[model samples]
Target: MQSSCRKTIAELGPPKHPVVSARSAGRTRDRSPSPMRGYLIPSPLPTRRTRTFSATVRASEGPIYKGVCKCFCRSKGHGFISPADGGPDIFVHISDIEGEYVPVAGDEVTYKVCTIPPKNEKLQAVEVVITHLAPGTKHETWSGHVISS
Candidate 1:
């Protein structure tokens, strides 16, 4: 483009003007934490809690499944077992238990499969025998058996 100002450089050289910038305003960046700037420094989240799980077996039934008795009421005489065989919890009735052994929650038992033989049926445990009682069970002693919770 042709210069609109036909005057020579010597005539236009010195003019009244000063450049303004952050540096001129004393706000230049220095790569250091700024005291004036507000930052959302998130505090470390509260220490996360950990979870634990019981040693459960794969669900199946044939050659004696090992499981934990989820719970049983002496009066109700029935409870569920989470089998180590990786199968869903199977129902265990008092009739299935052998000998004088009565189990409580957390008690370990070994048992074989027994089908109810009806529609909407699920596999159940029969011929159950208490292999071990978990420590701290309510059943401390029964029929001279020192059972653990």
Candidate 2:
């Protein structure tokens, strides 16, 4: 029985690329369906696409909350916010940040929270706006210029 199964597998060879219906794949009706409809060719380049945001993030219907910038790395494109209500620090993404200057530690900020996708166990700050800069500290703008606060 095992030999027969192995023989059948060997006869089939390696599996082919994933198949999808022409209509679902967005093929126009002008193209005639031949040889079991049009083939959905996979991209030649390796796929490393990452989803930076989701539909939930775009909703932005949550109440605003105040926080302090615990630490932010412009190069790394992420940081944490210390909630004013004394809650645990929440993750902050660079894309979600608003205003001109990049956030620094102790900078007072206002933001809304959004739960991360997949597991949805962790929270991240969205629509972050710096209300006040940390006194006597230097801040950098998105344009690569530095300014003292």
Candidate 3:
């Protein structure tokens, strides 16, 4: 019976339409005539080359400004800092952060400023150091262990 079933299944060929990956699928969701045809979708996350270039151009020797962590998404690899001087929140990349622990909301941090590329009108935080962890909140280390501070 098993041999007959195997012989019957062997007659069938491969699938007609092959699976198309998100990268290979150039059409938009609507599938309308798009000007971006054949162009690869840009990732929201920053690439390693971008991090290296920005780091080399912006040194860590500048005056450090005190700030509190507004919000940080470790998975997203970016965050915003509320400056102690009371201005717009500055963008901080994961590569810019120092220390073993990942930053959480309300954590006290000191960081240097760097102009965002292309326009240079916006500022971002670089060389970030977490001075104080937020009380009563759980903190996670880069090694994936959780600690209460």
Candidate 4:
């Protein structure tokens, strides 16, 4: 299992050339035009990758909550939580979410999100994968594990 810090660094490659700051009181004069650099260094920006996942919809239950226009907000630190009919929050990747059909708030939409878990680490909601459209009905009910008091 890779730590978050390690993963971040690995994703972001090492810097290319060392940057030198100009001295304050250095008298400099240039007559000839500066030569164009031969090779261009690659950017260090991290590559954007989309992952897919599935979860149910719930308000303030788990982490993610559906927002206006198919967009979802993360709960705590996890990614977006997709809503389903009476089920766990469906995790979906932000990339997998289609921008064409904007999902309205409270609309049951399907999407895909990323999921990463380390061995021995407790599983947590990371992203949401909108799969199927939940049936439209007022006052929906769900069943959960019964806990004996």
Which one wins on lDDT? 3
User: Candidate 1: minimum summed lDDT over ten consecutive residues — where?
Assistant: 46-55
The C-alpha lDDT values of all candidates are: 0.55, 0.70, 0.73, 0.31
Deviation in angstroms for 24 in model 1?
90
- Cα displacement (angstroms), candidate 1, residue 74, comes to 1.9
Winner of 3 and 4 under TM-score: 3
Question: Which model is ahead, 1 or 3, in terms of lDDT?
Answer: 3
Clashes of each: 15, 0, 0, 30
For candidate 3, give the lDDT.
0.73
Worst 10 residues of 4 by lDDT: 38-47
Off by over 4 Å in 1: 1-62, 140-149
Candidate 2 weakest lDDT stretch, 10 residues: 39-48
**Higher-scoring candidate on lDDT, 1 or 2:** 2
Residue range 68-107, candidate 3, lDDT tens digits = 9988878657778899999977877888788999999999
| Candidate 2 structure quality by residue, lDDT tens digits, 1-149 | 13242333235544555987676586434633232111211112111133344534453777899999987868656777899999977877788788999999999999987666665555778789999999999999999899998
TM-score of each: 0.50, 0.62, 0.65, 0.26
The per-residue C-alpha lDDT of model 4 at residue 17 equals 44
Q: By the lDDT metric, which is better: model 1 or model 4?
A: 1
